[model samples]
Target: MTRRPEQFSLNLRPGNLRSRDPDARAARDFAARDFMDGGGAPALETGRTRLLVAGMVFALAFIVIGWRLVDIAAFSPGGEPRIAATPPAPAFESGRADIVDRNGVVLATSLPTASLYANPRQVRDPAGAAARLVRALPDLSRTEIRAKLSTDRGFIWLKRNLTPREQYRVNRLGIPGLYFEREERRFYPHGRLTAHSIGFTDVDNKGLAGVERSFDAVLRGRAEPLTLSLDLRVQHVLARELAAAMTEFAAIGAAGLVMDAATGEVLAMVSLPDFDPNRPGTAAPEARFNRASLGLYEMGSVFKIFTVAMALDEGVVTLDDGYDASKPIRIARFTINDFHAKNRWLSVPEIFMYSSNIGAARMAMDTGTAVQQAFLGRLGLTRPADIELAEVGRPMVPSPWREINTVTIAYGHGLAVSPVQMASAVVAVVNGGEFRPATLIKHAEGERPAGTRIMSRDTSLKMRRLLRLVVRRGTGRQADAEGYRVGGKTGTADKLIGGRYARDARIASFAAAFPINDPRYVIFVMVDEPKGIARTHGYATGGWVAAPIVRRVVERIGPILGVEPVRDGAHEDGGEELLVRAKARASKVATN
Candidate 1:
């Protein structure tokens, strides 16, 4: 019942409503009759009406023919089009989220990029296209490009992760077969500075090392950056000092670690001979080795700190206990001697200060092997460090628990551990005997986690005093950062090369804590195969080479960490007179 009297629209039709010929012819009959017969046109419109009608019919037929031809061309009875230029769906959009240091400094991030692909079948001239592409991207192999273009595959990758300029140049070439698909390139803002910590990604942006590999799941499709406990400023300082020490001592490699003694959070970790994460593919294997956490070594006398702590904790030894270090002990084929041997009997503090290997071995013998191994296991040294890095070294302990093994391990030989392990163990020694699992993530302020107590609080306090005493008058004297109350041990051991210990090759290391009275940080540094230098008086020992590096690090980082210099303070036992005497003696020795 609906009325259909309205004019229909016609586009380019011969007899449309707007056509002059149609209007004139249709209204002529009415026009001649007069104004009484409704609206009309002028009367002279004659044969034009028939001509317009015929023309409209012919035009409609032509349109139908043209439409049919296009349909046949599109649907092709032969098969699908060979030159179909539809590109593959992208693998990632926006890519993985950013990675940042604890201070919100960007370490690793993603950048929008263009990748070129080719439809070989569509390439009219493979050789010419390949040549043009080579001109645009000289690094690309010309033979590979030509071979890929000649394939006749539906699609193939020509180049990946192209720069904006490169993409523009290639696009300007306007080769028919070439196409660009949007992608993202993984980038490191600091490049090699955080290479071992932030790690690098593959062409697909999948993490392969360091924190990037450990937290890949958290990063994928995540908008928020994954924040780590590392401070870039601290990392820079650590790296710079380690690099300088490596060059100064002519070391093959070096490692350094700075840890929060209270919270177990790693502030900074540096491994020399590091690679640029952005160009990891071209770096040497040695350069890629992460010495701080991934490489384990017999860390020499640094282990003495643990041995002494365990002895004091188990009541096997006391601060006043004395041991004879006048001569080396001959056990089996091994001779245990001290680098700085004291001719007479030495108290526990003197033995620690002088780094007497014989005294440390004797202390371990008294503590017993079973108890020593158990204590080390408790410190997480027998196993891999519980840090976030995927690359971690497993400690090398003796296969059979023997008496000699115990003694050698007491002075940090026979058993090899990573720098991180030594640093963490030292943290426990100074942090009121609490065993905190080292972490790469930050903990909230005043939200300290209760850790397992490995040693008595009384024993920890005594150990702190002994460490301070060593730094004050012992082999660790060079490690003293004035007013910082530096306290730690200097460890020197021969590197085992081939099948036997290499006497010429040694690992010199220093493990230290600052403001020993109220411990806040634990630092460890190791220089591998450092050749003796003239400035060090031809000594490759820890005290001479590694200790100074630790001193510099402490001095540089103290103010930044809000730890001001407290030059004057009495010992726990209130030995003000003895403290003044030691300072006077140190000043005299420095002047001499």
Candidate 2:
């Protein structure tokens, strides 16, 4: 039978090599040689070897891929399998401690938030994704976001601290490569009400200003909430009064402080034009300045408090002593005259009650410069206030210690002190001679820190009488709270701008204490650059602008603090007659 092509094809297998054609004979010869060498056809064996090698490579690759998946799922660094869409849960509480007022009102705390992030490499449409992102976050710039997404980076932060609504809106967009990371953000519930005291934190919860900056490490390390001496109720009353006064007087700014006379605990501290701690970045630098603690000003007649106190304590002058304030004193191109001038010889009490600058200068000269400086240093006025806030102002004192400087400083010029420093010093003068460092920390179980003696108890008692005389009949008459026995002094200083005192730009302030027979609290209010209004009789003096705020604040907070109101003649001291005689003398001098 003739051999068919199919027969030739079937005989082409290994070991079946018999053929008649010359090409087939050559193939058969090669097969026979391969068989003799104990192997298959050379080309076929080579092809099979390559196929086995390729199969092994594919198997090894698949095994490696499976092992990697297993490792990522069970042995990842975060100890959890990371899904592309959902991230791990955040801690319920923030690492930073909470800040609470005296009555346990939350001033500052942290809240959980979802921060938006993205994987740029996985983003299919960078431009489209960024455009959609802007809809959910209008504050974000589309151009900047697009540039961030178009990069080959594996991870990127789109936005941080997204609100619940914002996070939900972003999730609804269903954009690929977008993710959320749980984070804790600092939240100030009271907003601008306690901004200058509580301060604010950065995006990463780092403290930036105020008490937040002063106690940053403590807040981060401790678990218990920080208890501030601030009484939220007192804070509200003080801030409300300051704001109303600022608005009514059209003042550029305002600052006020209320402190416990016995313990030096700060009940309320306010700095106006304040920013909301939650959005501090949006506020102006001027607003962020802590005027209560950071601003230094020549405190005008208020400094007479210290001058008279110094003179009395040093035996340089007594309440019975007298000074010639009839004419302005001209010394070295500087003239010293009283704002509410009584152009006559006045007693020490008359000088304090009338806020006579010329009288104060003469009295301070009698006390001498070295004695005045040492007395102020003892009262903590010549240095930065020792408070819990980081923004404490260093007092600006006259460098040369000249006689002219002493005279000017006596009437609250040639020297500058912060409102906080003034408040603390006043506390020492009125609190039975004990000088305690001002603090924002709440005392434990009603216990207070021991105070250093800065003045004699007799001197403190005498100063209290003089302060009462001013509020009762003199320039600080507006600061008198009925039945509260408010005692205070008024201050109006020309603001020094570019080495010149501007007449219109003035720091009008009132410093007061209540129930002068037995002191309890001290309040200091200062209005910056106050403009005279019609209601104020075209006067932006401390008597017109700041004294009334002290009155209202004391009136409102007296009841809250459980301080019993004194009926007339209920709590009288023997010195009332002395003050009455002093006032009579001042009036007699004024009318002459």
Candidate 3:
């Protein structure tokens, strides 16, 4: 109705009145305003609520990030997130000290080396890697390397003791799984010259032979570097001379030693046909034998020294004592004859100078078995040398001490001792009657160990004079150096094989001491199965073969040992006057 009135009263239709109604118009306007305000507020509130929820989510996320940072910084084992530290490299085992000569020349030393190994777990292309490795190390079999690499095992050794160049080349390949372990390899610098004394070590650096084996514990950190008593210069000279002799005489073998009589220190010891300690595995058993200390033999006339010393020490005979040497002695199917029989009565001096078996047997009979055994024991002939070596041979003494044994032993038969024993015993006789234990180690300062007294100083002096006489005029005359007053004895004994003695096979030997007045050095030379040479008058006796060796050794080493040579006087005519006087005294005794 209001809408109709507002239309200037033009519309009389009901539809027009409905359209023109004021109450209807006002209701419609109110509904439209409510819809606009109320609905819009709900939509805006929903949107604001969604934004608040998003802010909460952001705050929660930041808390979690901060907590994790705190935990990592304060609670972690590796604090403060530092760069990882490289582990320290492991150290190598400390090496043993070197063994040097008296002149400080190197004899034995250790060299650092790399040993090849493999970590099979890290291997890639196992066959190819092995092939390359085999090529680098020809000593290793290719098939073996391939098998080792292909295995499921963790570790394996490819090779050991590679040279520096080899190690470098192997490393250059940079192949996976291949690695190296540090090790020490022992070396003997002088080769075969000092093989017997210096010795050799095993693959694992353990000492196995000669001096190395004897002192293994010391070399393995139990003690310090073992300073030996060897002199390299003297050792070289001795080996060279012995080799020359061996070649010239065409002998089966040879051995020699130069020892200090005053101290029992070995200056040089050489065994012919020796092997280099650096390559000991390639040598044969015979080459490895130490003839000077391990090969015991009947030492021929050199035993006479012990016999005479025993007689004198026991007061069985005097320097003037005499025995009938008119013929060979007969005992138990054995005949003892002098090689150069005088066919007359002889005194003690003549017995030694002429090397008469009959006179020596008579002297032993006077001394008796008890005194002889005791004397030999004192002289260290019945036991191994008290040295730091395992190769020493114990003397072969007759199990039952019979009368025949005594007689044969007196003449250097039916008894066997190493040349080292002979040299040590001889040193005791000439070095003022003291039995100092032989040593390979050097003595400390101001420490001179006292030795057991085996004989009177006077006896030692008399023995020296008699030995001097022998070198001057007796069988040992060949051993005399022109200026050096040398004294020694010659010995030639039949070799024992399979319990029977071979008369043709002989062991010729000589034992000499220089500067006879005050003996300082003792030299021993032995030739095994030496053949008779034309130059030696076809004789293989010690005087012909071993004596010349001693002479050369004395001449060479005399100057080195500071022993001055002197002119030979009438008394220096080795035991000649003593022999004549002994013969005269024997004649007089026989006449009585």
Candidate 4:
């Protein structure tokens, strides 16, 4: 019946009758529209488009999160961070104990610094990043940075150290793959002034030279500052004066030291052509050499000090003894003559004051080679200096000791010794004959190490008198500092090059002590290969070049070291009259 009467429902009595139930009519119309041919296609297409759009949005969010995680976890410039299942990197020496002078003035210390590095494999725009990096660090070469960044290496160092301000500037660039390592860099507060004595370290903070190396383990372990015997005031004074002398004389290099006569504590040591310890790797080999203790030279008449000391200590010669200086001594075609000959018999004081080569040779012979060698060994001269340095020069004394060696060595030729040895020996001669091992460490009160006696008090007294006489009236006349009572000897030696003495090259030196009535410090200054200056009257001798440096140093440091001048002399001391007696003896010999 339904099939026969399908149109029965279409009995349109009136459209208004169906409109009476508008809600139901609407639903029926909707159902009919869904069943119409080709109507379902648009609905299916709309649903699929909406679903695809939602999925794409979620996938993009995940992709962004993953990229961010990659950047933060592996390539952040802040440094590598450990996440789950990842280990942290090893730590480096972030700080070291401070190195300070005796008064706690900082000489060497550590500063917090930033060092730049990069993971080249993660660098996307290597060339662009390097150019920008170089802009922040203007000293960095652009090409080198690019090459480092373009590599496939996991990490590379861009710079070892950067200032905090520079680090901030670099961080603002916001480049990828760059990182910073927190580190402690060795910093020298005085720069080139303390370079040779304090030395420097490697990039990894390992000590390489000078006191830094000798006390590396101590520094690494201690928290308190390492107090050196050096006084900054003294060091500055010595360095300034030496530098001026170097410039004035046009010297290639210079070395100087001031040591405590009693305790053997080094107060100041300077070596030049010196470079800044902060950048020691860039320094030339010549500049890095510590001439104070490392360089060996035939120290000329400075050795006369030792010869006279040896003779006095061994009782082979007395202060009243005389030596013939009539002519140069000739041995095996090598002639030894005084620069200024007296051509007469001279007393011991006259020999030293005149720096007579023939007298020195005769004195050394009287002491004999065997006793001379033993005496020097006792004074720590036949071996390396006892100071705490890796660069100590072993004394070049002749082997199979012969008479010729003795004669030549007496006048300060044939044997080569370090200035440290020369200075220490002078210390023994002047400081009541006590031979204390030289040290860079500051000793506590009563904690000074025991010293061996190298000479008699009588001999030491004579040495003091003679040294004063030399500075007062002889070759070291220029070394006198008013009120300080500077007593020293001038030394000049021809530089040996290619096994022959160079005509125009010389080592000019002055070894001195101040306040000779009561000694406190010993100073030794040496100028290497000094050329004569016009102001110096065309003479590069120690009297002309090195003695003035000593005078200036003493004058400047005397007040600083609490050494008061005795302006109102009681006039009771006639020790200097001994020089007059020595001259009288020479005159007596001449009259005879």
Candidate 5:
């Protein structure tokens, strides 16, 4: 069998048997011929087989990538399925109520802002990320930023109150682990103009001062905007005029308030050197102090209004009563002398017009301590004002109610009350003897609260006439508004420091009511530690310093508040007639 190989049969296993088909036979014959010709077999070479397989694999990969592109661009439309699309992160969970003026002008608001934060664990290159962040936020130190990023804390605030430019620059960095938290930041568009009344909020979106603190819970949860009684136009006028006065007098501090006498709503309250609520940390302590409601001072002769009103209300004196002011009265160790003394027997009208301390003391004696205390209590002077603000001051009244205390309080000394308290009391006397609680929030239509009656209607009318006469002919002559018939009393109290009154330190205040016939507005101005200027004739009295401020404020705000000026004779049927009759009777009695 081995002699002829081609014809011989070879034993083979089942897996090694060759096929007998024509195609297989032809392939085997061709392969044998090629091998005999010293050429490689047609089936495949070592490297070529690998090359062909790799080419097929590359084509398949291209087809797959193209299909995926089409699927992403056109096939799938609603949202990405392969990779989930992230949702926008929420900003502040708690929303704040809008603050608008009486005229619906936006005073304070919360605006959407992007604040930078970081997830320390997710940051790859903390040092590099911090450097880029610092470049974007100049206020942030590189070391501090790096330390915050490297910390173990899961989250940390990197920067707040970023500008749009800053946000864009930070986003461009594309640093890993850096993120933005949308937040609502409180903003005051009017800046320091309404600082005292509107107040400001803290970093946690909580109210910390002013009306913001008073109605915080109401503002945060409610959807309705908080409408305030403040009129932006009137507020601007008051602030502008007060700032001018503060600069002109070189005064250490200044305060002014405008209120609706009929409604007891504060229109504007200004305390000088006021800071923007948007940046409260930079404000001085004096600026944060609400002088209208927190700073109590013995408001000098303005107390004369209370004294005279009490005397009339108690029936201890009449408009026809006369007092002997022939000499300064010596009571115990205190001597009562008028700033401009009229050393003679003066009628009650004369006494008020001249601002005689002696005359005021005698009037208080007639009213008696019990009656005086009762009158003040009824007028809401013995307690803090019932307003929404947290910075109200309780009136400092003598505990013992001594004889000297009563006499001194009569002339605006030995008693301490806030300017707001004084203004509210004055409003009671002029607003038909009703004491309405002052309010910062706007009341609903037809929802007026009934006020307490503190004085008789007759006493109110009589006091209105007297207050008008004081502005027209007395030391408050500077407070006269040309057509408004502004009437008020001037007070100059020596400020108490370290338990003793400082002769050089003074708190000059003016309390005035406009359209004195039917009083509609009450304006109060106070200047603390005012220096006598050469232009002011070197006098720091309330009449010279604070009275002029009230005059300007009234002239500017009266028009804005819709208070039209009328001729003095127009009020003849109201309180002017009563004033004339009362003055005539006093003169006749004095002559007798």
Candidate 6:
């Protein structure tokens, strides 16, 4: 500048200046020497090189960082972490599928619902928020809700499955932390109408009983509705009639079902004292029982169908065969007698028509225990009923099936089976001797599963004639439907109470197959502990109680099922076939 300093620094001085201090003079001499050695330009170049190196180092560092970020985002494997600019968009999910009957009537379905939740930490005043929530949902406990709101949790469920009005009320309060999350709730449109069969779901939409529990996975995996073999109309008729019978007879409970004899498809099933599946928690435990498939009972004379079929199929007895049912067979403190006793020698047809227990027991003994056991197994009566229902009951067969057991079981006493199992076995007896497993799944039009042959076609035909004869002239006469040619047997078994039979507490039931000339449907109805009234002449027997139910159900459902009605003498089996053919077959067997 204006004047160059004599020394640039305290330790440096220009060579032209003379310093007084010795050290200063030495520093000036060294500075002059160094400047001369480097000529000053070299030192300036060194400093500029250092600055360039530093700039390049910083540039390299920034380049490496930028490249790493790009590689991660563009080339990283799916298993590795990748940086995302934003969260993914939500997807549209259709919840659980619907359940419908064969006619497309909705029985169960899922509906989109909003569930109330809250961020407890965001709640400004716990007491105040709970107070407002209680006003909207009175069912929610105020104390419990207040405690939940006071928690430090970031997320909490205040209430689940809120109604639209409830959600509105909560939203109107404008609570800061409260929010609504979308959810789906299972709904049973038919309610108690199909409670035991369609089943119910929990609050989280998980199936809990009946067909729902059995087909839970299929329901969640598919979007299309599930179709059942059940016909809603038939189900309604069966339930209505059963309920009326239950009321009229003052029965403790009732169960009934209608099965396609040829196909083994259950068209309708009903268990009285049923509950509303939509509000299952509010119903009594007894009301939720599935009696048709789960209740095991000694089905009295109904078992005679199987006994006679077994005897006929095994060639142990013929229609022309006779048994002495005049005297009661007293066996080891047990007596086998007929409810409608005819104290005389009776033919097989007469014994069946009269429901003679002594005759059935003698028939079973002639067939032997092992043969009876095998025969029942072939009919699918010695095992659990093969159905789609989750509540199916296993048959209670004697472990060491002895002569006494056989004798008692012949008349439907020692062995206990479910209504569904009995019906399925009866289907085999009347539907051309083929045993088809009962199923709830719908089949294609004109399609039916191949059944296992348990008896000969001839035996099946003979059995059909006998069933018609029973309805025409036996204890099941009341079960006959005009023009339907209903054929069945009546069963009245005393319920076992406290290890003893209670005469008053009886299981009255009837098993029938209609249009016996060409059987279409099989019907079974049971009333538990029915009290006899004046109308029944103080008789709570199967003929007086359950037979009427079968008749009414058949008359109403026959037309619905498209079964043509036949006039008397018009049906194929209207003649004396059982009498004429049995005599001829007996003569032929005797001649052989």
The TM-scores, one per candidate, come to 0.76, 0.78, 0.77, 0.78, 0.78, 0.77
lDDT of 3 by residue, 226-338 (tens): 67888888888888888888888889899888888888888889899899799889999999999988888899888888898878877888888878889888888988888
Q: Note the clash tally of each candidate.
A: 0, 0, 8, 0, 0, 0
Q: What TM-score does candidate 4 reach?
A: 0.78
Which sequence of candidate numbers ranks them by lDDT, best first? Answer: 2, 6, 4, 1, 5, 3
Give a tens-digit lDDT track for model 5, residues 1-592: 2322332222133432475656545555655665667755443575688898998899899999999989878887757477777898964454898889988998888887899999999998999998888887788999999999999989999998787789999999999888899887888899899988889999887999998899899888876679998888988888888788888888888888888887888888888878878899999888888888888888889999989988988888888676888788788888888788877777777788788999999999888999899998888888888878999998898999988988999988988988788888888989889999888877765576788998799988888878877787778899987667788999899988999889889988899998787888998889988889998789998999999988898888787777888855763433344446556765676688
Error of 1 at 73 (Å): 54
Cα deviation at 139, candidate 4, in Å, is 3.5
Tens-digit lDDT string for candidate 4 (77-103): 975445555566865444578899999
Model 5 segments more than 4 A misplaced:
1-93, 118-157, 172-177, 567-592
Between candidates 1 and 3, which one is better according to TM-score? Answer: 3
- C-alpha lDDT score of every prediction, in listed order: 0.86, 0.89, 0.83, 0.86, 0.84, 0.88
* Best-matching candidate per lDDT: 2
Residue lDDT tens for model 6, 513-557: 988877999999999999999998999999999999999999999
Q: lDDT for model 6, please.
A: 0.88
| lDDT at residue 380 of model 3 (Cα atoms) | 93
Give me the candidate number with maximum TM-score.
Answer: 4
Pick out the ten consecutive residues of candidate 1 with the lowest summed lDDT.
1-10
Q: Candidate 4: global Cα-lDDT?
A: 0.86
Model 5 residue 547 CA deviation (Å) reads 1.0
Candidate 1 per-residue C-alpha lDDT over 1-592 given as tens digits, one digit per residue, 9 for 90 to 100: 1211222223224555455655554554333455545444433244577678889999988888878878778765857677988799865456698888888999888999888999999999999989988998999999999999999798999888898999989989999978889888899989888998788888888999988899988899578888888888889998999899899988999999999999999999899899999998998989888998899999899899999999999999866675777889899898887778767676677788888889999999999999999998888889989999999998898989799999999999989988888899999999899998898887877768789999999989888888887787888989998668788899999999996989889999999998888899999999999989999889999999889998999999998888978857644433233345444544454476
Candidate 2, 1-592: lDDT as tens digits:
1444554575667555544567667655665675667755677879999999999999999999999999887887885546666666864557799999999999999888999999999999999999999988999999999999999999999998899999999999999999999999999999999999999989888999988899999999887899999999999999999999989988999999999999999999999989989999999999999999999999988989999999999988888777778899998888887877878788888788889999999988888989998998998989999998889899998888899999998988888999999999999999998999999999986697899998899999999999988987789999988669888899999999999999899999999998677889999999999999998889999999999999999999999999889877775653568766766776776687
**Candidate 5 lDDT score at position 28:** 52
